[model samples]
Target: MSTTPDRRILIAEAALDLIAREGLRALTHRAVDRDLDLPAGSSSYYFRSRGALLDAAVRRLAQNSRDAFTRSGLEAPERTDDVDASARAVATTLDEMLLRRRRDLLVRYALAVDPTIDPELHALLATGLFSRDAATTLMAAHRSTQPATAAADFVGLVEGLVADRLIGARSRDGIRAGTADSVEQLARSIAVFLRGLPTESTGTRPI
Candidate 1:
């Protein structure tokens, strides 16, 4: 690496890629160095310890997630008045996430499950809120009587679907093959939930 700040960021990103594809066992200084075609000891030189390297990867993942959501126009709702539109918009974002950001998601789950082994992983996941606030806001705009609860439910629904698909895809049979259709089904389910909710004038906004 060039020893610039950008180099550190790039190294961190490579660490994320390593974890995303090959699990945490693959995230070593030498592995990252080799993956990025850098000189031996380059990764350890930049991030002195394994914990430091993991922290950097978490930060990079957070930034990448924010950028992805912003680019997909899911950070904010476009047509708040139309519940169906919001559902489709949110569904589109979920689809993009599963299709393009699967690696990040895998890394996230690994960190979540390995927190006991690496306590820093817990703090790292805590710092990165996972866009829950945005989901709440979008649900609120759709006029949910309990936007916070509804948003939580909707987000949980999508998460379950993605997790299942990811697991199934890696199985021997590869039984789950339809990403677009899954996202559409999720969107339709969310729309149905939103449309069923009775509109209310006042409610506590999600924090």
Candidate 2:
């Protein structure tokens, strides 16, 4: 009588761990099988092809990233309907979402780091979800003043910050008590800039 492992759980979790710890480039059906201490062909049983496994993994990564954004973004606004307040919220949300998602964001970053992925996948990587959200927040707060052109600018700000942090231009505070302080400061600066602009149409609630 031999004990067999629950193959599905073993593979799915191993795929995620591989992506999280190493990167998408390092993931392969055979490698995942090895990582899980299972015999070869187990991964192929669950996911028929490499494309299938990557498809599943990318979908999981998208949902996880979106959820992280919503968790921090959807909180009750500390200053509702005010330009400064909304900007603060966006900035705070950006840092909180990025920092809170240590492994997921890092994995996403790592995936894009390699230039060998499918071109379509790389295109998806370039899309900026946070920028759109930030613009919506800022324009909703002060549409009457500067005009609602925040879509590009706001996204640029968050993207720049994330890039800076990842590349060392931004200060390192994550995993420390000072992380909150740095994020809070970023929130204030963004709020100040956004408040000065004219608002756009009221933004929609997250779908």
Candidate 3:
């Protein structure tokens, strides 16, 4: 507790834990307070309304997601390369990330079905952070591609692929199959796209 300087992140993490263990319906102020070992007014102090709290929760989840992205080596130059080398590095990385994100997907799926989940959550789910826009922008920068539409398609492809794997793993069936060729397919798709581009590639993988 002494080491945690950011209470917002702490509160956000607590909320995530609650969602992970219970469900999105469990993300009330009372639940956050209980999870954080705080007094009754603690949650209200930080978030005066339910909307505020839920917004904070979404923001926190977003921050955590960005942190996880960088830490999972997605931002590393070696991993961000445009060729098969980077592809391999990232495939290995996403394999691990896919496993972790499976838990988040399960929690999110529970929220999606629950009528009590916040509207903000529904909004976020509708336009996810890994959306086609974000993915396109990022993939473009990563691959040095200029066509926004094409870049976004690759981004969408990656997002859809990752979501597919995560959803399957999160299913109650508990089967976590699909890999290797999946990565190869994605890499091949991105590579073919990049190869067709007018820009002289930096010898990187397409997506």
RMSD of each: 4.3, 6.1, 5.3
The top-ranked prediction according to TM-score is 1
TM-score of 3: 0.64
Q: What is the lDDT of residue 30 in candidate 2?
A: 92
TM agreement with the true structure for every prediction? 0.81, 0.71, 0.64
Question: At residue 147, what lDDT does model 3 achieve?
Answer: 46
Considering lDDT, where higher is better, how would the candidates rank from best to worst? 1, 2, 3
Local accuracy of candidate 2 as per-residue lDDT tens digits, 1-207: 432344554566677679888777788999898998878887898789887777556656666657666676543333245554565556666666566655656666776777766666655555624535545544554453432456566667777776666555454645321366656667776665665554334343221
Residue-level lDDT of model 1, residues 43-104, one tens digit each, is 89889998789889988888887888779777766536676677777677766776788788
lDDT of 3 by residue, 9-35 (tens): 677777767777887667788889987
Worst 10 residues of 2 by lDDT: 198-207
Q: Which scores better on lDDT, 1 or 2?
A: 1
Residue 165 Cα positional deviation in candidate 3, in Å, after optimal superposition: 1.8
Question: What are the lDDT figures for the candidates, one per model?
Answer: 0.73, 0.61, 0.60
Candidate 1, after superposition: displacement of residue 120 in Å? 5.1
Better of 1 and 3 by TM-score: 1
